[model samples]
Target chain A: MSAESYENEYGNAKNALELKNITKRFGDLVAVSNISLEIKEGEIFSFLGPSGCGKTTLLRCIAGLEDADEGQVLIGGEVVNQIPPYKRNCSIVFQQHALFPHMSVFDNIAFGLVEHKVPKAEIKMRVNDLVDMVNLNGMESRWPHQLSGGQQQRVALARSLVLRPAILLLDEPLAALDRKLRKEMQTELKRIQKEVGTTFMNVTHDQKEALSLSDRIAVIKDGKIIQLGTPEEIYESPRTTFVADFMGASNIFSGKADVNGDNNILFRGDIGLEILLPNNDKLEAKEIKGISIHPEVIGIALEESEIKALDSWHTVFKGRITEAFYQGDFSELTVKLNESDIELAIHLGRGIAHDKEIVSGQDVMVHWKWEHNNILYS
Target chain B: METIKNATSPQSDLVVKNKKKFNVEVPLYMGPISFLLVGFVFAPLLIILFFSFLKTGLYGEIVYEFTMGNIKEILTGGSGIVFLNSFYLAVQTTILCLLLGYPLAYYIARYGGKWKVLLISMIVVPSWVAYLIRLYAFKTITGTNGIINNFLMDWGLISEPLTMLYTPGVVMVGLVYTWLPFMVLPLHAAMEGMEPSLLEAATDLGAHPVRRFFRITLPLSRGGAIAGSILVFIPTMGDWLVPALLGGSKVMMVGNLVAQKFTIAGNIPSGSSLAIMLAATLILILYLAIKWGGKEAMEKLV
Candidate 1:
């Protein structure tokens, strides 16, 4: 369908960027399978996946750097599939900054303006404003090589922002910075996006970065998006085992779900463990093959009596502590259940009673409420 | 503590032994090039300088009397015209080579892909054939009854054979053909060293293809252009073979004038002075080129 009709039919007039059945292939390998998504104006969207999962390829297709073999890319309600990258009006900040080593910081930021034939005075004013916005004031005359890695990245950001593109594509922009600097830049990037009001589409493999920085995320694997939702939805209600594992929910139990009396469902794990699933209207009891519980949701008690006082809705597992790790803010205990050989990862906050005294080989009971279980169908 | 000391002592001793061996190996590595520089390069230059200040006998023998007449003769005579011709031709050849070489070098560096080695080899392999043989081949192709004229005549394009030889233009063709590879090699090296992402960044910044080339590619490859210009200019200015074979005395360069002075007139003193002047002029030009091209050009050439 034509871009106008597609937008009219879908009522996506407010979407800053929309992809319809976008697919890219590299010879025999499909780098990006048929994927469709819409990003609203002034929203920070991310494509999160492991390396080589085609997140970068999807971003490139959106930026017009890579042509989609089959599909339409509509930006601001105009189809831009045939337009080249320069004319598409979507700027990109590359992973390595890709700053012009030959040009000074001011000239680098002014390059797009000069190409567009902006007046000289206005170009200088816009570049100066961007330099100040990205916190690079008084560095207009320095070469790219003279700046630190973080500083160069800021220059790159300012250079792209000066164009005021309809959509800004960031390809692993913070993947090169140190952890602390990455966190700092994450905050800076959010502030800049808010101030500019331009839609941001970032591609990264870091789950934490995507969770922290993105308003909505599409988790991709093997050239297809397995799930697309807000950060909280993707984290708390993963629909597939891959999404669950990718979101850091390390406790996945593959089992068979059987319906019980009065609409109750019980999951019997293959490893001889069992749990009562919470009531979910959308779940098919026969189709649920597994379930995932986040590591932080599982609680540990030194004695069975400690958790026995709790209500009946909590499922308890008697286990012995196989290993303990003392992190700064919390402690991690690996519990091997006595009923089965299954190991469960539990996190105990520093405020928990006797958390510091927890040691390896200590007997313990691991328990979690049924409401914390996220059912996985496949 | 004793064990740590014992462990460290052997390593220190080994390091000292390696240092001693390295001291001896340094001269061993530098010996051949140093010998060649002193024996072939410096010695001939020093002899030329010594001969320029001496007098010449009637039979082209070097007379052991110091004289300033040879230098004075050059300054007062029509050698200025010869110098101007050489300068003009050198500049033209450098410009032509740059115009033709930059695009070819950029293409090979950027898009040659797996065939890059083969393409660059095609450029370099022809230069490896004997220079005189290649010049003769070029002459045969451009001669009056050569392939181009014959082909055109067969096709009824021209009525008579054109005067395609012994002109300054053919001399230029010969000079450029002889030195084009020198221009391409350094240019290719400089262009190949550039990061491809810079061009992509320029494109993403709303610069079109032509604008991207001028703004990003051209400025980044300036080092290669300067180095290629120098590589073409210095040799073309002093070349005698092209003018001798192609110009046939119709267009005499400074090299031909110096050759006639030494060979035909038997004026060794005058020839040496003229040669010294040419060398001095080239040195000055090289200094200026390096100054204008800056450190980037120097680094690329080295």
Candidate 2:
């Protein structure tokens, strides 16, 4: 739901929430360096990273939980530096499903409403509506502990959303759930964001979670946002070695840019092979060492004569398969061209690979759509 | 029965199967813990249960006859005042402990740095010292010429030493001091178990600091609060030492009443009955805590 909204096509509104040179330090450890980003109104922006990457810390700074040593936070284009969270029109759902254990589900959702001094019948109506939105109905009277982990998360969501805040912040809200439940919640959260039209900022370490839920994901690493892009951009065209590698495990080959040219950059390595990088003129690698292709993008053994077929001129090649393995429905083949190790995983019918008797150490032609190849720098 | 089992369904079946696989092989936290629990936890309780009902003589010897008369007399008169007082003191102690210990726990949990281990040790190690020694130290501090008054006098802040010790107020002070660490430890345990993101979530949710404390911190650490109170409340109810040393004779708590009945009045049966009543009241409080926790609270976390 979110991915489709602020896709690369729609780079999100200029700014609803903006962080300026924010930095957080805990004694000796710097949690977030001087980094900044702009989140659009009603945008489902996500801070994506591994655990301890300061995504949650950054979110906390936005929430006013942790003071940023160096930064400015603007909400709705207003400088909110002096404002406390309660006055900032934001609500947050925590990773542990921080539903008030003492209150019933109904009361838990109604709590913020009560704090804000909303009217009795209106609070009831809003709470019930939220509970229904989260697919929690009759369970309102139950205590937090009585609900399943998933149910507790829903209540947490309900509790935060019922307050009608300008922004809803979620800190790994689905981290506690099992895989099935997490996916279900990701969709539910997306639907809720769309329905409420409230900008949702989520912090998550899970790549899939961020990709599935975020309209735009800011990839944070070592206290800084290294890349901010849509899931498709992040997946199809990762900008750095870390971005390329961290997105998923892939076969990486580093080389020197022997020839730099427009639309095609020729690369050479100790492997005795020269490869052409199409549409990549700049690579920060002193030795064209930054170009890469995803494993899924590499096609299996096919016809060498087919290389002459009309297509992007720079994509077809011949190599020898050195290793192969059946990864679920698809078969992955490791091919070697000169000294460079290239892994080509092809999506195939489960039985076809063995039926065709594709073997390792066999000479195979490698082919890919030009767009699947990405040239990484630094 | 088949229908009932069927109604329980796949999830319950999995639970039962796991339960049989694990719980059947060993009782919950078995081996030394099991043996020691039966030895220390139940054996003394069984003995006390037996003696509370046993008839007693003027000489404080058991008459070996079951009677409710002793239990009745203790519940009836001025004795009820002590009952009310014990309850009032326990509630006060619980509240004060929560107030003092919660911030201490929160500070330790969130902000306590190199001093955290030290602070935690300070909270816990004092508990390891003999209970009598701690109470005696409390006595020395809160006495007529206690440390506080003496310090005030030496500083010429007061003309004479004030009478601060040996009153209901003194008893409460002692109880709060004694149980503050109890509340801190469990609160630390609860707050420690909490993800820091939970508080961050509240803050991000636009909850003010005070609102976050009430809405998030207080509710989440309730387990620790309940555990701390039970730890402090159960023992403090029957405590003779604090009241005797700090509260003096006029303070006359239920514990002092029990002491008075057995030692001074020479009424063994009445003391036994009062002891039994104390046990009943503790049980009721525990029941209320469990009920307050609600059905969700009963889930035994594995």
Candidate 3:
């Protein structure tokens, strides 16, 4: 369909940006394939994926830096595929801040306004307000090189925000910062997005950053979004093995499922393990091909009586501790199952593992509630 | 106390031995370049400075009598016109080279891609041909019966041949052509050092192509432009060959006048005084250029 018709059909006033069947290719390799999504007016939405998964490429398509081969880009209820980047109402904060080294902080912020020929007094007011917003109040005359890395990023942010674009594209905005500063900027970025009331489309490979900062996230892999939902939904229930693995679920087992009784399904893992799963209304027992359990949710006990004392709803397995890592806040124990050679990662609170003497080569019983089991179809 | 003294004595001896070794190594490393600078460069300049204050004898020989007549003649006489003409030519050459070189350098740095090195080498390769021979070649191309005139006449574009050589314009062209590579190399370096994302950021901030060029690309590459101007300007001021071959007598520069005093007129004192003035002028210009270009760019060059 044409961009105009697409805009007219699906472009609601609430949606700040909408992309339809956007496909981009680099020579023969497809960098972004047939992707369609919408972002709300004031939402902090993120595209989460590993590096080279084409998340940045998708963001560039929205920014008009890269044109989509077979789709339309609509912003604020207008088709903008034919428009150049300078004419679009969206701005991007690059991964490397990409601040103009020659221009001062004030001039850098005022650059877009000057290009648009805004009034001189208004430009000053806007630039000063942004400098204050980004907390670089007294650094109006300082050059980009003189500022620290975080400070330079703030200037880059301020420079983009001064234009008041309809949507702000952040391409790994805090990826260049060190860990402590990245956390600080994540909070700062959320605050700034709220204050500006502009739609934020962020791209990042850091899952923690995405989970913490985004109101909604699209988990992308191999140039296609495999899952899109809120952080809680994606983390609690990933649909595919890739999403499960990428979201830090290490104990993934592929298996066949059979109906055991009226409401219970017995899953036979390929690794010679068996577990009972509660039958859900959405998925039939035979269609389920895999399961993932979060490492932190698994409980370990030293004795069979201690495991037997758990509720009947929990699935239990006997295993021996193969490796134990004592992290400062938590201890991680790798347990190899007795019935199978599968190794499961179990994270216990620091004092709990020390009190139990969970060392390597110790026999243990591992159990987790059935509700914590995340079923995967592919 | 006896053990402490024994320990200190051996350490002090070792420190003295290292210090002596360093003293020998310093001169050993610096010997050749230091000798060349003093013998070939500083000594000639000192001799020229001394000769500028000596008197010229009747037989066109230097008489070792202290006099400032040569300096006074250069300062107050018609040689001032030559200095002015040389300055004008240098300015014109620098401006022309800048106009031509900026785009070429930008193209090579921004879009030359895999051929960037080859393209830059192409610009530099022409300079490897001897300077005098290149000027002669240039003369043949623009001479009265040269390629351009013959082409124009063959095309029936003009009834008569155009005067293409021995003019001020021709001299300006030759100087710009000769010194253009110098301008390009520095500009290319500056532009190459610039992060390309700056241009993208500018575009994302609503700056169009033209505005982006002026606001981001131009100001960011100012260091290169300044360095290039200095490179082109200094050489063109002292260039005597281009004018002699292509400009004939119409376009006389300070370099040609100095050469005349030494070779044709055989006036050592007069030539030395003119040379001193030119050198002083170049030094002053270089100092001002560095001050204006800022220390950061000069540091990058070094």
Candidate 4:
């Protein structure tokens, strides 16, 4: 949601966090450009992008770990641009997890409470509760070096959460873990966020992590927000080529659109071929960009009779398979249209992909519903 | 599991094959160095040990009697005071070096950035000058007729020259000046290797700057601190030049006492015994430091 709608829906007092036109520059490079966003109370929001794309920079600016060259950051609708990180009421889990190597697990969790001079009994109770929450109950007395990477990450998460800050910022908290551990931590993170009901702002370059864990994701590139929406919305209707490419592999065609009727437009691909799109009012000019169809959305069939069985709203193509790559559970077919230079990627699962005849140079028909194609405006 | 096994089994087989190759190469690697170490190092230490157990003759001859008298005297006689003074001076110099050098190392590591190499070089450049020359330079600076006294006289800050030379304090200043780089270099290395994100996390966790330094930076750099203390403390314990030149006759350390027995008094057995005692003290200090600092301390030196 936009900041205005967020403020209206949750009221100013409950908006949780907001950044108004925040920008940060380092010497000759603009690390984060003019970007404004809002996260609602108890929401799990994510900034997703490749490295050097300013997603982490933006998170740091919000956490007051970095001073933005322009604009204000708000926590609970209170402007915190002048406050230091300690006073901003936000805690961060660093990308390295940053567990204190010298301190025991219990002390690392109790560090913030000790700084605040909380009562000894209360500190013990709180740290124990957090240790249980992060599933590190019995290992409290062990040093950070003795723990594994996953356990260290749990300590880092508990350390930040024990303070009960207004928001928790995570900078690729699982990036250092193996793929299997990363998936496990993703679920653990989601569960903890739900239990605590704290606003979470996670930054990651892994699209799968953001898709599976985030309540809403902001797709960023070149220090700007390319698109911000729910994961399903972004997956279904990416507004830019970068978003489509970043989100996943897709058949991308940049072309001009000519109005066909009341609700239809013909997109002539730059490389070749033409496809139909349900007209969107946002596009007023003939110049069209980021016309993409997800590979999974396109269906493959061996016979022309099967192509005829598809609905009228579906766009079909007669193509020859240029290459067939066999993945363990599926096969990916790179298809070049019979009379056009345009290539479309089709993914077929094990049942349909096991056919002996579906090799390179095999003739096939590809089709997808018009609604599955995203027509982006320049 | 399957992928890892497939990838590593061949590499492990190659490594096992290489071990056979290493067996043939061992003589080439170990020959000259082992021979040199045994000839020069172990032979001299054994000779010293032999001398230390012998009795000293009246005219400084090597007597044929075997006795532990020299070692007994060093432990029980008034020479204990000299060892005490030497240890006191070394500890004081180490504390001062730590106090002054930690901030310098921190500044260079955190704020020097592009100028870090230049700044570290400045600390190291003075070592290139001869050690005796540096001591003489200190003498000129602290003497009654030196530049400091001359400048004070010209400025009318004092009517006569202050007795800054040949004092225990001046000796300490010299020792600290000489060893400060030893302390700073290791600390700078530790601070430079510190992951900056750790400090950022500390700040985000509601720690003020001073608290963060005390709680995080200080503890994490303990390895460097311990290593630096060993580097400065051990050598200062046996250093003769600083005490001899800067301290004059007023401040006689264990090193000067040992040197006097060997050269001025010409008592080789007595001198070797004294040297052995000093070496034993240094070893004790090293053992204690390594025990306290753990493997992390030794790792930082590497």
Q: Largest DockQ belongs to which candidate?
A: 3
Model 2 chain B worst lDDT window (10 residues):
B293-302
Native contacts retained by model 4, as a fraction? 0.81
Runs of candidate 1 with Cα error greater than 4 angstroms are A1-13, A350-356, B1-26, B295-302
Q: How big is the positional error of residue B90 in model 1, measured in Å on the Cα after superposition?
A: 1.5
For every candidate, the chain B TM-score is: 0.91, 0.81, 0.91, 0.91
TM-scores of chain A, one for each prediction: 0.94, 0.89, 0.94, 0.94
Clashes of 1: 0
Off by over 4 Å in 3: A1-13, A259-263, A282-286, B1-21, B295-302
Residue B252 lDDT (model 4): 94
In the range A1-378, model 2's lDDT, one tens digit per residue, is 434555553464557788899999999999999988888877888898888999988987887767789989888888787787767777778878766556789987887787778899999889989988999979988978789988998998888888887788898889999999888988998898889988899998888888888778888999999998888888777888888888873745566665544656666644544566564544444634556677766655556555667466556667777777778787777777644554444444457576657778888777767666676666
Q: DockQ for model 2? A: 0.36
lDDT rank order: 3, 1, 4, 2
Candidate with better lDDT, 2 vs 4: 4
Model 4 chain B: ten consecutive residues of lowest lDDT: B293-302
Q: Which run of 10 residues does model 2 chain A get worst, by summed lDDT?
A: A1-10
lDDT of 1 by residue, A225-324 (tens): 9998778888988999999999999999999988766577888888877887666574567789888999899888776577878898887888999988
- Runs of candidate 4 with Cα error greater than 4 angstroms are A1-13, A280-282, A354-357, B1-77, B155-159, B295-302
Model 3, B91-205: lDDT tens digits are 9999999899989999999999999989999999999999999998999999999999999999999989999899988898899989999999999998999898888888888
lDDT of 3 at A367: 93
Select the stronger candidate by TM-score from 2 and 4.
4
List each model's interface RMSD. Answer: 1.8, 3.0, 1.6, 1.7
